[model samples]
Target: MNGKLLEGKVALVTGSGRGVGRGIALDLAAAGARVVVNDIGASTTGEGADLGPAQQVVEEIRAAGGHAVADTHSVADWDEAHAMVQTAIDAFGRIDIVINNAGILRDTIFHKMTREEFEAVINVNLNGPFYVSRAAAPHFKAQNGGNYVHITSSSGLIGNFGQANYAAAKLGVAALSKSIAMDMQRFNVRSNAVAPWAWTRMVNTIPAETEEQKKRVEGLMKLIPERIAPFVTALSSDAAAGVTGQIFGVRNNEIYLFSQSRPIRTAHTSDGWTPESVIERVFPMFENDFYPLHRSGDVFTWDPV
Candidate 1:
């Protein structure tokens, strides 16, 4: 409440009815941004919709003397996603920040995953951001400046069991954010993605089959949504103006700058070679550079700080 970092800014945050999105919406409002809280209020698996969740967040923001409006629009729909941007423009006269945070999970091992399962997650998590960000691009360009904060996931950055669709969608988002940053840099529009590690309803779907698993989940539970809000708010504000096209991670007290993909090793031959020759020489040359098939847990083994 003390820091009016986003004073006079108009922000639109999708899936702001609950969890990490809700925390981000609240923090932006508290920083003096008039907010358009967009949430379809669907179940974790992307089924059914209600207005209760979005409306509740709007009420809470208003009670705190912040400006906010509820928008029960599905981010997956192109028309509805554009309408969300319009809602902010109609209410606040202009939009300055767009946070693509809407998402759902349809967890299953890759082999067992259905086409429907894959498409459902992709539509909401990946396509949803694409629609909303595309809709807002013109406005951002017109304004001469804007900010985009996308909610990506570590599941995609690393890998995770039973989340092939979710991971693919999230990784797509990070790539999309980077592309947006590059294309919109001339327009003064900054885009970045955050892979948040928070305990939310989607995370609860993971089964704790062993004592160690239970303990780990318990540790994750302590990394509440609130802990990630500050960094998100900072990224959305002018305070992070110099930063863009970067991937970040938030877990409890820890904030990570994730390394982007780049060539670790390369091999060259003086003459054109057959597949067999290349396999014998080039493959062995980069053996140490090859990454292990690590799952998300293998990378983030420690508890949140």
Candidate 2:
């Protein structure tokens, strides 16, 4: 509730021209971070560019006495994405945080999904984070401290029908964050992800035209906006530095920290095994100790057996 939680910090947020990205950019600014707002000004389908959204967010931050600047960079390109981080350094002289929130949806069933559709989703949702985070990693290392939060989605964590392209790309983002966290632990650069279930323009792609689909949409309408921001803000804070390589479903006024566990193993297998024996004994462990597809927090635990 106190402003200035991020006082003196400089944050770069990608895809911050509108929707959830815009919300995060403004919130970070209000918390006293000088923000670089990056957006390609692209549409939901990742088409076209208009500088209005990024500029508007900057003005809003300025009007509210928060420091911010606009950046019109496509996240898919390494050069432009690097420039985005450079803008933060140029203005504030250092980078302390990054929110990889830029994304686009190119939904299609696997059968009907074209290579173009798949690549577009992967390039924006997955590769975009890759480019920005790659550029920011060094700066974070030099400073010896920083936070990185990637905006993932429920569709990726829990599979969605007709979202093969989007889901794969989002899951890739999660995987990328995990690797970054593992490598950056010694440098104090924490990395994590947030799986948001908010109502945004991205959700418009969900097929809610049918009555059944509409009911599902109405059910989700109960989730509030305030509930989503806290978890994301926490992930981008000093308090969450100890927590990395995780994912959280932030909605419904509560934060659920996701965890993954390897399936139990009864024995080491030989090279040649019988299918029946494997199915009866080995597969049972998978039923009980399966890792969560989406996870968060410290999974390494020591408990008395």
Candidate 3:
């Protein structure tokens, strides 16, 4: 129990071939979980797949005297997602933890964003998690316990430029996580979302043409992807049994519990509000509380510790 937080547990980590996913897979394996290192080895834009990355991570785990298996399957497809989960069960008898970390980017400003760009990001980032989690739902129900940790983004939680597609999908994931937690509570299945700030391959895509963008990139570089693994692994363990339906963030050594959407300011009139009245009364009342167009970087201005 001292060294093995997940002893006897079997975990599946999507996109485990590279970057943040790779770090998470390694950590989960080190924690005594037999891992299914699933990755299509897709590039940042979700094009092309290679088997090398997944296999290499599996080999690394084995070299460390840990158990892991490689699986190359696209999480975007419903059938393929199920196959990935089945790989875990086939190899380890049962799967106890799932980390939905596979994602793609097609960043473009709203005015210039194309349908293909939008759909592509949505399919992988949003639909992929749903497919994988849905596939695992029955098994979790049968076993009476399982954990899900989805890799979300602050782009959605806060806001970002040139990432409408990504933000939408990530925000949707947060909602999905919460809904899953509520629905599966009786079955002892838990779900949560984590927005990780790290200099991963995904973050590498951010252009640093301007000084501001360069600064953001520099700050991102300070956020080590591996730093996200500890919190995620702990959350996946039975030790976090009472923790579910939460949104968290990990940046460098900083772990944050983010606030969810709740009614902060409310206003009502004795009579039904007309559009004109609402504009006159409600607008001013909520004006101070209205969130500004601050990007994730803007909000986290301080250097990572």
Candidate 4:
């Protein structure tokens, strides 16, 4: 699992200063990758910056006899993202894998959410991946081979209470992953989205206002970030040759394949139906198939496996 998987591969893992990203960076390096540990070193809410975290991870990798460098560029900025990509190329000569793992949480009730809150989450979570991936697109095309792993979330894939921004951004990441997979498959470039359910700083920021929320948080605490890395490492390798355009999940030892949005149920009428007809026929027919307003916790009611 160490040198056999990713020997000589160069990887860039954003937000690698702590939590899930940190776990991933360490795993990639342990698997024989020359990694670019990129982190803005900001708070969980995506404020401030420090070079210490990234540098420390780099030091850790180096001390372990793996290769790595530190990058402090903001993945949300187009120019900075390009620079981050450049760091990989400069450090290891070429980048073979990109982990778009940088993100921030700004959870607020939809109605009460401000534009700033929504945009901030979108900037780091959604736009950051796009920026970083786009920056690496040319190199991937040039090499005619590459792997992209976008860190998506269940908040968007399923539903959540006060994370419209995070959810929207994460779901958009799923679409982006799919589109990239389709668009770049001809070039032998692979793109996939992963929704990692780990108890990281991100999960720690969730508001446990209600008793149910508190219990959910308690369940989450058992899911360590390290559990999420092995699957990601597998996906980042050539062993995942034909795996692209898919949404996967990792919670503790459990791996999941999520269902994308599709027409689960349909009703047909030979003639054009009136509003009344749709209500009477379609409403009754679709009632049983309707999805409940379930949060991420509601769906994953079982303890982490």
RMSD of each: 1.2, 5.7, 0.8, 1.0
Judging by TM-score, tell me the better candidate of 1 and 2. Answer: 1
Runs in model 2 lying further than 4 Å from the true structure? 224-226, 264-272, 279-305
Query: What lDDT does candidate 3 reach at residue 304?
Result: 95
Per-candidate Cα lDDT values, in order, are 0.92, 0.80, 0.94, 0.93
Question: Per-residue lDDT tens digits of candidate 1, residues 148-207?
Answer: 999999899998878999999999999999999999999999999999998998888888
lDDT tens digits by residue: candidate 3, 84-112: 99999999999899999999999999999
Stretches of model 4 off by over 4 angstroms after superposition: none
Worst 10 residues of 1 by lDDT: 1-10
Highest TM-score against the true fold, candidate: 3
Write one digit per residue (lDDT tens) for candidate 4, span 199-299.
88888987789997798888888998988899999999999999999999999899999888889998999998999999999999999999999988789
Reference-based TM-score of each model: 0.97, 0.88, 0.98, 0.98
True-structure lDDT of candidate 2: 0.80
User: Lowest summed lDDT over 10 consecutive residues: which window, candidate 3?
Assistant: 1-10
Candidate 4 weakest ten by summed lDDT: 1-10
Clashes of 1: 0
Q: After superposition, how far is residue 168 of candidate 2 from its true place, in Å?
A: 1.3
